[model samples]
Target chain A: GAGVSQSPRYKVAKRGQDVALRCDPISGHVSLFWYQQALGQGPEFLTYFQNEAQLDKSGLPSDRFFAERPEGSVSTLKIQRTQQEDSAVYLCASSPRTRTDTQYFGPGTRLTVL
Target chain B: QQQVKQSPQSLIVQKGGISIINCAYENTAFDYFPWYQQFPGKGPALLIAIRPDVSEKKEGRFTISFNKSAKQFSLHIMDSQPGDSATYFCAASENIRGYGQNFVFGPGTRLSVLP
Candidate 1:
């Protein structure tokens, strides 16, 4: 079976530019999550979606970060007006059931803001 | 505020030795404790997990020791091998009756096992 996958493995953007990262969750997975991982640090949660409805987004750093799962299988994390501080790896994970289940993580998209 | 705290930002152990990484969490409501392993560019993989109901859980060479009262947990790798070298992260989450969960992760410990 295929695991969660992310696209544009590496992305470089200029400051103030906009970028959208994509995540394809496992087939039939019900829970999707986005996390940001800084260099030498643990991953921090950004948002979560169960099916097509977003359940929690309190972890989003600011208003610039937006995420959506329109069809409930693919998700996109969009960052508006990228800043130097946004240079980090954005990871996506999915679970078969609820968030309590084991989560399969995507390779992640490394974004570098210059 | 760091909800979860881990010690020894990095660790190095020789083959056949034991590697131990410790973690402490502040929230008592956290019922789930899980450990994840990550390589250079890959995403984190679930290594093992334990619940507050159990004090210890062991699988193969990995063991998780949980101290409920102390709010601490540790991962012990017996006979550590070079292939086991990776960054280990400890996370805690409460089982809220909802669609989402808030997982608080530790700073992570980079483990390097020497051959």
Candidate 2:
């Protein structure tokens, strides 16, 4: 694809329920990132992947939040036991390389925890 | 902790006026700064970027002013237009790290350009 793409543009999950969001980065992009944005707030970095390597997960709020890019292309962010506070737009971005490169973002998945 | 801080959570500017948004960072390791513009229901798009080596950079009607000593940066939109109304975010990153590593973003500033 020409740009990064995310699945399930909107999702509603009951409290304690599990949900998974998917992201497909631009073809051949070597770097992928995940971010969380609350209402009216900026996107907060959650994790980063260099190809299939999960290099940084420092920003994940809790142990329940997990992300993986097994094939170095498609990625998925899974949240277990969702809470109301977890409600936000999850953004996915990708870049060409590890150097100072421009990141392209997806439309984002708006998750609502009820 | 948030490495970057932004001001003027919201602003109203008349068309043809200038819109300015400021951001400050605490980390000196940051060398790259970029601004993003986002409209409602859409993802953010890169507007302009500047490196620490340059004090200022201009592209079309957008300008980025950098102050390495103060660790501050600002975005200036000349002749602001209604189409320019959107949320702007300032972000910083270190070159030593990978593209997605430790990228810090400010809280964001929403600009409303009125005709």
Candidate 3:
């Protein structure tokens, strides 16, 4: 009955620093997704994973953003050389299949790069 | 060219009044539309969803009206209450891979219901 959860609810990093955000999907869920939400804006897709394989990562802003889901359970979104523009809430969601099915979202990790 | 455009940015309604939020999408391949509700410091929660097959779907006091020809959709909340005050987002989903989906979200509309 537990929903998706994210860690380090808040993170403040200096420019050029590296940060890794973690996401734990719901039990038995087969689909995982990452999104970035800016202030006063809706969330934009960052990457998606089906089981341990990443199906789409075209939404990733740049090469600095890397995500991996090993063992088909937990996922980590890593941002290398953080920039001021990277400041936003990173959201993770899990679903049984796709967005057609209801996806449960995590509280999100707010990252601020100064 | 995949974009879900939401309008009115914000809305304020009195108790018992109706609240309506509209969204238009450019992609016709989108087959699933869902509305998400979010409160401060919380993740978005699914409010209602509609498939292209149906013109309209109503759940409790929330209703989703879909216009397939117009490529638009709207959310109507009846007897809006203060508890219903939150940000609403309209999203379009299209399945790309075997089980992968692409979600295009609107800018979002902040709704404030006065007591």
Error of 2 at A89 (Å): 0.4
Which model, 1 or 2, shows the larger TM-score? Answer: 1
- TM per prediction: 0.98, 0.97, 0.97
Clashes of each: 0, 0, 0
Worst 10 residues of 1 chain A by lDDT: A95-104
| Structure candidate 3, residue pairs in collision | none
Q: Rate the local accuracy (lDDT) of all candidates.
A: 0.93, 0.92, 0.93
Candidate 1, residue A3: the lDDT equals: 88
**Models ranked on DockQ:** 1, 3, 2
- Encode model 3's per-residue lDDT on B32-102: one tens digit a residue: 99999999888899999999999999999999999999999999999999999999999998876575568
> Which portions of model 3 show Cα errors greater than 4 Å?
A98-100
Residue-level lDDT tens digits of model 2 in A37-90: 999999998999999999888899999999999999999999999999999999
lDDT of 3 by residue, A1-114 (tens): 488999989999999999999999999888999999999999999999989999889999999999999889999999999999999999999998654468899999999999
TM-score of chain B of 1: 0.96
Arranged by TM-score with the best first, the candidates are 1, 3, 2
